[model samples]
Target: MAMAITCMLRHAVTTSCYENPANGSTSYFKTLTPVYYPPNGDCSDFYVPISIDYEQPEFNPKFKWTDSFGLQSFMAALTARASAPVPEQAPFVNAKQFKGDYEIAASFCTPRKPNGNEKKVIVATHGIGPGRTHWNSPFKPEEFNFVQYALSKGYSVFFYDRLGCGASSKADGFELSLETAKAVLKTLVKSVKEGKYTGKIKAEKVALLSFSFGSFTTHKAISEEPDLADAIILTGFSNNITGINGNGLLRSFVPRIANIENSARFGDRDDGYLAWPSVFDLIMNYFKAPAFAPSTALFTQSAIETFTLSELLTFAAPANISAEKWDKPALHLTGELDYIVCDGQCKGIIETPAKEMYPNAKPLQVSIQPAASHHLNFATNATGAYGVITDFLDAN
Candidate 1:
């Protein structure tokens, strides 16, 4: 019965132009390729290509006003006030008050051999996917890796799973919202500040590097708690700004009144990136229905099915705010051909604001990786180190 239902559903739906082009309309569809996440876990975290080789000391230029290549990595990009890595790192508390079995991890890296007194800290937060282990190859421990790259430079590195994603326990999907994500990260930072589990940290002086969904949570933290990080680096992400009414996917199925009521909690509207493509068809199939008709979970059965690229436009522009509200140094990195966060969107959300915020700050230095997709920007022909990321961080 389930197979019959599934086949019937598949037949009823027609793939967009990419899948099945119309008689005269040009097809804009691209192949949907699955990304391979290495089982040894070396390909998960946002990483850089290792092909470009440069000595460590030579890479960290000593002079302030020297002409240098654009951002090497998000960390090395900063030249603000001699931001060095923290002295040491000890195991801190996990994100919750659980009483069961859990794994705890920690490590230290020095950008330059510490001068014994100068202390700096850089903490990396993972996206809404696998954990640290999956990012670094267990077999080739010393090969090109993000953790190893940072640790070699002296930045105290810390990363862990977010609840059920990795070795951690699992739970409902909606619990993975921006709020819950922020709370978990805040808890980790708090543990470091208080020296609760393993001592050794300068809580006041902290930096943040987050990618994808992690970027949203980090931005919310900075917006809510000004003291969390001295500076923030947001790569491959943009704010989810939605203000339009009654035009999202959910309206096609559920009553507009019902959707309006649920809008406050379930994001701006239904038919987000999750419900896209499928939900788009739903809206077109039942375009003439009264405003009160319920939608078919038809194609967008899961929350993941609620989103489409079209909806992203509604949230690309920055929200209005005073200059004083954002005083800290921020670095925004994006590839020119990013299929997910379109270059245009990045310009509107980050590039333009960065120019206004830090006028003297170099032109929103962008790394235009030709023919690169969203994920490939961070994880590409490089190994061990995130050259682009570290370069962006060094650009201050």
Candidate 2:
């Protein structure tokens, strides 16, 4: 019966965004700002001072898949050599609470013309190996940028780099635990709600849009503070690990320092990061072809970001959270071919698990994008995923 219900939802609204284009009335500027916040409140009391880089844009950058023959060649050579055996990761080290000041990078986009009403803002958090760019593709923006699409629908979007990723403050790999992440997100939400961050546009309510590991952080945040967001969208996620193709996923990552000389794109990044040596491994484990352009794969490899050891250990830590306290609307969407989260098939099996996880959510919807993998936004059918998200937000 559960499988039957999931199948029905899958078939009812599986159209790609390309087939059904989005329409909107406003255009706005993409402005960058720095937001500084002090540690306070229960969630933030553990915080150090932090500066966040923010972006406000009316549209995404024009899509362009510029060739990087040299980078491509280097990647090919790295992939050819056998991957080194992954070393036993160091044990988790919890950062002392209230460790002074740090900085984070973030971006925001709003419609050009205000609708004369309280606006709804979506705060997005990216997964490991990608920062804000994960939400808005640098290459092929039109085809893969969810941020621009949300803007087209008159929705404001906020994206940020986690403490140890992208333009944010760098920390020892073990310093970025789940508890630290929850505090960071909680503080950001509070600042945004108070109009301290994006002052020009005060948000009536906020929604959370998270991908992969970001989804994990979101889960921890919302579980602790049930009213954190009016609505929540979880993508590239699942609570079940029994189905994951772990072996294939594990082999895809090489230590950042393992091939530091070849990774010119990362410059002098430290051991806290990991890199994907094989585009083939990425496609097989994270993306599905035909649904994702070849260039998307290459660009993903070239622009890969760091994934902290603290995050990995935190992810592996046991959790016994209950969603009975959550009462907001929630949605869980994943690619049908998500090898890591869903073992290449998310439909028919995700609904039950999601229900168990978000039991008290008013309307918890779970759907799978056909022909996509874990990285749905980069897939050819990304517009479909985007449409599903905006539609849910509109309905709620």
Candidate 3:
């Protein structure tokens, strides 16, 4: 399976979706309800694919070009600086071996003055791309600063780069597979569950904070390995289509005449960079004759580059693991103006789904930070509405 995972990308078309066993919702698969085609693909003889079935001009802001230039430019600067030289320090503990070709690297910071026992431990993971260690830019350091903040509060912090990312080694090309990714997470949880390293650090319970695609991957981890984390937070949730799953069919098969009207009214921004994830959604929306426009390609690319297409499929698929199965308390947060992830999509998947199944379970608190972009909202000690998130996490 491990070897197969590394090669899955070689043949993976564009995007893939999962079939919901419990519900008939083939969330990933379906034809445009406004129109239909025959099974043999012969209905195309008379059917024209150019009619715009629905229109939402306002959605343009959410999916427009240049909308996220400010944020992305800042990130780029940070990454460039972080690439500079830095002193190396020994890891607090040894890296743990996981499933085939995977390893979990952890860095620990014990409380300066232990009152009685070790302070609480929070395990964190960075979103896609790069390694566990962030670049030396202000924003990247901001992440380190947050971890340091936890330390100040007498909390030990453990973070690692996901496979094919920071610090961790990967095979050539490093194809992304949910099962392979989950295996590494499961291994980390198992080590914690069995108290392998509990003796060194008195970690009472592990708290996990994941953002963007990290949330999706983390959710899968918690679902498959119950003992992985005691508390979980998923930030920036959404449902978007991918390029591999029939999204490309529209661009390739649609009639040139019909595409004329729609292309002029709604289409991708050729001048800018459209991340892989957003490209998939745009293609899907364009095919369905719906407005799949995003504010900018950079924002979508941020998401697409954050996690591999295979990982996105896991997030979009019907969660086989239900809230009822999640024993630990979970908290949800989304940025109000987070066009890439979108607040509505986050609530739909995390908050709404949890409410339906676990009637008696603790309510999943959802917080929306006004005017906050995806990264800024999760920041610690942030001024204005962002402070509210810090306060909530602290109070909890």
Among the numbered candidates, top TM-score falls to 2
Residue 2 displacement in candidate 1 (angstroms) = 39
Best lDDT among the predictions, by candidate number: 2
**Overall local distance difference test of candidate 1:** 0.37
Tens digit per residue, CA lDDT, model 1, 1-396: 343344333422222101111122211111011111222222122111111111111111221121112211221323223345633221122243222222223323333443332234556665532243323322222332455555444454445454333333333222224444566667666665554322344544566776555655676666667677666766555432322121232233222211122332223333211222233443342221222122222211111112221122222322222223446666655433443455322334445544554344233343433333333212333231265555555454
Could you give candidate 3's per-residue lDDT for residues 1-396 as a string of tens digits? 332243232422121212221232222111111011111111111111111111111211222223345324422332333345543221112222323444444444445555433435556655543233321111222322444344444555555556544234332221344555555555554555454444456577677766655666677676656557777766654323321232222222221211122222112212122122233342332211111123221222222222333343334342335556665566666655444454222333434554553333343566665444454323232233324433544555
Quote each prediction's TM-score.
Answer: 0.47, 0.74, 0.51
Question: lDDT tens string, model 2, 8-80?
Answer: 2342111211110012111010112211111110011112246432211111112111233433433344334
Candidate 3 wrong stretches, greater than 4 Å: 1-99, 114-118, 134-144, 172-174, 193-199, 238-307, 318-321, 343-351, 357-360, 376-396
Q: Of 1 and 2, which scores higher on TM-score?
A: 2
Judging by lDDT, tell me the better candidate of 1 and 2: 2
Better of 1 and 3 by TM-score: 3
Query: Could you tell me the TM-score of candidate 1?
Result: 0.47
